[model samples]
Target: MIHDQSMQRRRSRIRGLFGVTAPTDAPADAHTPVEGERARLLDAIRDFLLGNNLDISAANLLAAHTAFSGGNPRLRRRIGERIAAGEAISQFWLDQQLRDDGKSDPATHYEDMAVRLQSSVERFRDTTSSARNAVVSYGRDIASQVETLAREEPAATSLLREKSQGMAETARTFEMRLLRAEREAQSLREELARARRDATIDPLTQLPNRRGFEAVFEEEFRMARSNVEAMCVAFCDIDRFKCINDSFGHDTGDRVIVAVGELLKTMGTGSCHAARHGGEEFVMIFRGFTTEQARERIDAMRIALGKRRFVQESTGDVIGKVSFSAGVADVFAFPDRRNALRAADEALYRAKEAGRDRVEIAG
Candidate 1:
């Protein structure tokens, strides 16, 4: 909703004021001091939120943090390029990137869905409470009328019959209303449950998403600690995935993703835990495996996938061999899981630099 062309006019001021550039764009010794870099990142995040009229909500801020925090180099490059080209960054664009990158949820979709569900629950509670009170009050009225009629007063018998008829009709109407309310509330409850489940799943690969992966990781971490078992975390990324997207289109690219996800998913069917970390990136946790052991397992998957040739379904064009690079780190060797994962990512980068379709183990 924050899309506006006029907002781009301020982008010129941003570039001239803050000399923020990605590592690829800067010279070898162009690194800023750590404090200076931090300040620039903070300023960039604040300016991105305020300048684009984007809300300072969790999604926006998270996207901003990821873009500037060096966690997502591609996102940073994209933002810099857009600003350099005098294009305004919109909320829609940010949300699309979030969906694409797996950094966080898109916009406020989940949060808003949660709020709506909570509101429905409260309304349902109120409706049920009101219906219960009405039933109790009606019961009291009926008892009083019955007691009076038992007094054998013939003078009021006709009036009592008329009042009893009205009460029956009123009770029927109330029951019907309560039944309708119950049905509606039940449907809403089912929808809310689905929404919660959907939030943790990746629609593209039918795999657990980043959030889902974290949940799995936390559980596995506790288990590994208790059992005194060795654990390894691997970062796997498709080699030159953008080239496939450009050559065969996103549909073929998706097939490639599905192929890799399926193989990893099969691994998860066993003791391993696998998830889609983001675009073209998958993470896996292997319990009771050393770094080299995990590397061999991942390399086997890499070789198996590389042996298969893909064809574009529409044009029958050969999409060539698809393979991925992976980096595995022994979780027990690191101080924490986060550091171990970070080391894995760094090793993955080294694997890409050395060659595609290979595996590297973090030392």
Candidate 2:
């Protein structure tokens, strides 16, 4: 009996840690071993994490639970073989994942922390309310006693005056506490908003990273679908990027990427978004633009970049010009975003095959 109780306790603790609910139904046999149930639950959790290509670290596991529970479609769609390959997930990988999802912004974390803090604030408020009520009730009781004392004995009036002075001080303290709570809540909200914006932006190019691009793409795609407007997606890659990196070193290569990003940013308007889609690659979404319009814009950018010269800072040697190739696809042409992206990729391949510095439109 003691062993059974201990096993039950262990199982309960495991369930609590994993955010799993305890079984409501009793076991068929009283002799059923608790180890079996515990192992089963643990195995199931491990399998779920591995299947989803999520890291099995404590933080990641909890994040996985939250993602699954909240039905985060972006994270859901991102699950792939790369994450499921049984490699240890490092902090860098987590950050990369965040960047990919456009969630590199601190805002999401801030929001989560704010939510938890809000709950704590609510509970504290409730407790404060109860305490305030108790104080009021006590004050009322003291007033009644003082009133009785006045009728029975007038000498107790001075003592009642002292108690009233103390009550006033208590009220002031309560008011300060309430004010502090309000300030804290407001501060947390602002911090969360700031975090979100910072997380989505890439420091190198000062542009939205892959995650940010995904967010913009999804929004633009939805808007286009609803309004029946034309939308285009373009994939741009620096031509001979490897050659640049090998010839001039990574620092110069980075400078080229930054320069390209800036140029893309200039081309962006309210209806357009430019993003750094990882190393040497960029993505642009043009709202209310057909494939041809997108192709024109991309070609223009390519030619402009080709005309611009880059000089190596250290040696003062002219590094010559940089160019890029791009593929443009009409969002409405394909059945889904994935298909459209695949088509754009194929077009990009063709552009590379034909020559390095041109734009190709998806058929």
Candidate 3:
């Protein structure tokens, strides 16, 4: 059931990306014209790329086809704008925008281990303390009985010695049990922490994935509401990212993504959080920034990215520049976190509609 739901969601996203509507009851043949048009556009894009010696990556081809099919007016307009800005449009340039994996940090692992060990130690200490107390009480009772036996019957001294030995042996056994429990708990805690970190991070980009972002968002939302402070959420999508993956290959795409991730990490500090939302989209949280301030910061990043150039190291070919569109929203202005995210997403759509490499603030 979960798999089916996931597949349906994937199909929905594909349809949305390609500007296809949900299926209707019409006969399959009724969609032939549309499919044929898409095919023709795809062929045309292929031919154009080949004629111009452009890199023919799948993402680039798809972007070109989508633009030619008139399915995505925003993408078409973005292409035109790039040309107008005196930037050379090529497969290499497009490939420079779309992009990935990784080992766990030793520091984080050690820190988690330390915390687990500390908790285990504390637990063991408590258990040992309780056991010690029990032993002390037992010893007191044994001593009292021995004293009585000594007074009532001096001949029972040998039996009293056996009883004291038994009590001492029991205390030793309890201490061992506590030590074993501590070891087991420590092992379990380490595994749990490692699993949690793996689940929350994107293996490819080494950035916090969607799940992690949601957790952070919820926490920030709660804090903002409690403090009555302003917070902003911004959604960013790389422009023509598909083209980058198509042109240079997935490896190059991965490099591009890593570069972007590093840049985001640098930008996301001082009460701000940045995460890879999925694919070529990223989301950021700004704790103290208003919508306008968030927009300015995002726009600045967009400009910075656009100005940076990527190069194919092996061939030393310039890959041109990459850009992104962003939308920023003031979370406090919305009724809930969900509403704030929706508002930011709508604003991002507007930014893309206006042009790529720009930022829009939700009103």
Best by TM-score: 1
Worst 10 contiguous positions by lDDT, candidate 2 = 72-81
Query: Count of backbone clashes for each model?
Result: 0, 6, 10
Q: Write the per-residue lDDT of candidate 2 for residues 1-363, one digit (tens) a residue.
A: 986665455444433322344533333443444554445435434544553345668866654443333222224223322333334444566556656544333444454665676667656656665666665676666667767877787787887768766875676677567566656656655675565666667778988876577688888898888988999888888988879889888899999999999999988888898987667778788988989988988888888899999987888788898999888888788656755665666577567667879999988
Off by over 4 Å in 3: 1-148, 194-199, 203-206, 313-317
Q: Candidate 1: where is the Cα deviation over 4 Å?
A: 1-61, 64-108, 122-126, 133-137, 152-157, 332-335
lDDT of candidate 3 over 1-363, digit per residue (tens)? 986664445433323332243422222333565575445445446544553356777766766664545323334444444543545556655554331101222333344666676577567666766765676677677778878887888798888778877886776677577666656766766676677667778777888877677788888888877887889998888888888888767677777888887778877675699987766778899997888887887777788788899876666667789888888888878655665775677577768777778898888
Judge candidate 1 against the unseen true structure and give its global Cα lDDT, from 0 to 1: 0.75
lDDT digits (tens) for residues 80-103 of candidate 1: 556666677888988877676644
Q: Of models 1 and 2, which has the larger lDDT?
A: 1
lDDT of each: 0.75, 0.68, 0.68
Model 2 clash pairs are 102-211, 104-199, 105-199, 106-195, 107-195, 107-196
Give the CA lDDT, 0 to 100, for residue 144 in model 2: 71
Q: Say which candidate scores most in lDDT.
A: 1
Candidate 3 residue pairs in clash (backbone atoms < 3 Å): 57-246, 57-247, 58-246, 59-242, 59-246, 60-243, 94-244, 95-244, 99-253, 100-254
